[model samples]
Target: MAAYQDTFTSIPLSELATLAQSKKDEGARFINIHAATVADGFVLTYTFTSNETVTDNCQVHVTADDVVPAISPLFLAAFVFENEVHDLFGINIEGIAVDFKGDFYQISIETPMAVPTKPEHATAVNTKYGATVPVKQRKGEEQ
Candidate 1:
C-alpha cells in the first residue's frame, strides 16, 4: 500500500474563502474545518481531499478579534464547521450562508475552548455545578 501524506499550507486569513474556492475549482472536495487555540490567537485549518488519497490543508492564524470570511458561499457544507468554530472557540467568522448567530450549540459558556487573552480572563472551564474555574494560567501549554 502506498503511504499518503497530508500537506498543510499556511494562508492569510484574508485569503481563506478565496483559497477554499480555488481548491474547489481544482476538483477537491471540502472535508472539514478545525480550530485550535494558540497563545496569540487561534489556528483554523481547512481540509480538502482530492484523488481519493491526497489531502490538502490550508491553515490560517487569526486572533479572536479577526473576522474570518465564511466559505459557505462557495461550499454550502462549510456553514456547520464555521458555526462550530465560532461558537466553540470564539472565532469571528462573517457572512455565513446560514448564520446561526452562536446558537449552534446549547452550551452554557461562550467560547469554552478559547484561550484566555488577558490575566483577568483566566477562567477557561465551566464546572458541572455551573461555576466557572480557571485552568492552567499560562499563555501557551507545553506539549
Candidate 2:
C-alpha cells in the first residue's frame, strides 16, 4: 500500500477563513479542527481531505484574545468542530452558522482545558459524611 503525503502549512489567523474557502473551492472536504494551548498562544490545526489520496492540514497561531473567523460559511459541518474547539480551548470563533456560545457541553468551568492542568491543582473531593478530603498526590509528582 502506498502512503499518503500530508501537506501541512501554517497561516495567519487573519487568513483562516479565506484559506479555508480556497481549499474548499479546490475540492477539499473538511475533516476536523483541533486546538492546543501553548505558553505563547493557542495553536489550531484544520484538517481537510483534498481527495481519497491526499490530506491537507493547516495550522494557525493566535493569542488568547484573537477572534478566529469560522469556516462554517464554506463548510457547514465545520460548525460542530469549530464549536468544540471554542468551547474547550476558549479561543473565540466568530461567524459560525450555528454558534454555541461556549455552552455546547454544559461544562461548569469556563475553558478548563485551555490552560495546562497540573495534577496538584485538582479539586478537593468531599466525602458523603460532609468531610472535605484533599486529592492524594502521587510520589514524585511536581508540586
Candidate 3:
C-alpha cells in the first residue's frame, strides 16, 4: 500500500476561480469535481493532483441560492464535470469556457440527483428551484 495525504480546504465561492488558477500555476492537474446536496445546501468538492502523490480537495459550501464561479478559465477540463454537477445538483455555476446550461444529460427531470422530497410537498419545499415531480409521473402527468 502507498501512503497518501489528503488536504481539504474550505473556500468561499467568490475566491474559487482565483484559487483554482493559482493551483494550476503550481502544476496541479484537475482530477474531478463533485457535489453533495445537504440539508442546508450543497458541498462542492474540487479534486486536484499536484503530482502522483499529493492530492488536494477544495471544498466549498454553498446554499441553494449561491452561484459558484466556474474554474474553466484555469482548467478547461473542469467544464465537463461542472456541467454534470449543475444538471444533477442544480448548484449554479457561473462562467465556464463551455457552458451546458444544465442540459448536460437531457434527462426528464432537472437536478435529478438533488436531495429528494415528497412529490406532494416538493412544490412548496423547493420553491427556490420549482417543484420536483416524481420520475414516474413526469411523463404523462402535469408538473
Candidate 4:
C-alpha cells in the first residue's frame, strides 16, 4: 500500500518488496508498498490535468488483458496479485505456481491460444498504391 502510494514507475512487485525490506533494514521508520490499484477497467491513477514544465503524469495501471507475473524464490504478495489477476481476468496463478494445470486464458484442448490476427493489408483499401501488398506474401504465402 505504502509502496504504491509512492511508486512512479512499475517495478516488478517482488523487486519492490525486496527494496522495501532493504530500506527497513537500514532503519527506516516505515516501509511503503508502491503497488497500485485499478478500477472500472482502468488502472487507478494519480495524474496532473494541467501540463507541467517537467513532471510527467504519474500513473500505474493494469487492465484485465494485461498482467505482470511474479518473480521467484517466493514473493508473499505475488500470489495475492495473482489472485487479483484471476479475479479480474479469469486467470489461474496458483496452479501455474505449482506447475499444475493452469492457463491465464480459458484455453481449451482444441483451441489453445493460437489466435492469429488478420494481416494489415488484408483489410486495407489501397488498390491505387498497389494491391495492398505484393502477391508473394499474401494468404497461404502464395508466391
Tens-digit per-residue lDDT, 27-78, candidate 4: 3333111223222223322222112222222333443244434321243333
Best by lDDT: 3
Name model 4 segments beyond 4 Å from true.
1-40, 44-59, 72-74, 88-143
State TM-scores per candidate: 0.79, 0.78, 0.79, 0.26
Candidate 3 wrongly placed segments (more than 4 Å): 117-127, 130-143
Local distance difference test values of all predictions, in order:
0.79, 0.75, 0.80, 0.33
**Pairs of residues clashing in candidate 2:** none
lDDT of 2 by residue, 51-130 (tens): 65677889998776678999998899899988898887677899988998887878775665653443322221111113
Off-target runs (Cα >4 Å) in candidate 1 are 115-133, 136-143
- Per the 3 Å backbone cut-off, how many clashing residue pairs does candidate 1 have? 0
Q: On a 0 to 1 TM-score scale, where does candidate 1 land against the true structure?
A: 0.79
Instruction: For residue 18, give model 3's deviation from the true position in Å.
Output: 2.0
Cα lDDT tens digits for candidate 3, 1-97: 3578888999888888788878888888999899976666778999998876767898898877888888987899999988998888888889978
- Ranking of all candidate structures by their lDDT, best first: 3, 1, 2, 4
The true-versus-predicted C-alpha distance at residue 16 of model 3, in Å, is 1.0
Clashing pairs in 4: 2-33, 3-32, 3-33, 3-34, 4-33, 4-34, 4-35
For residue 4, what is the lDDT in candidate 2?
84
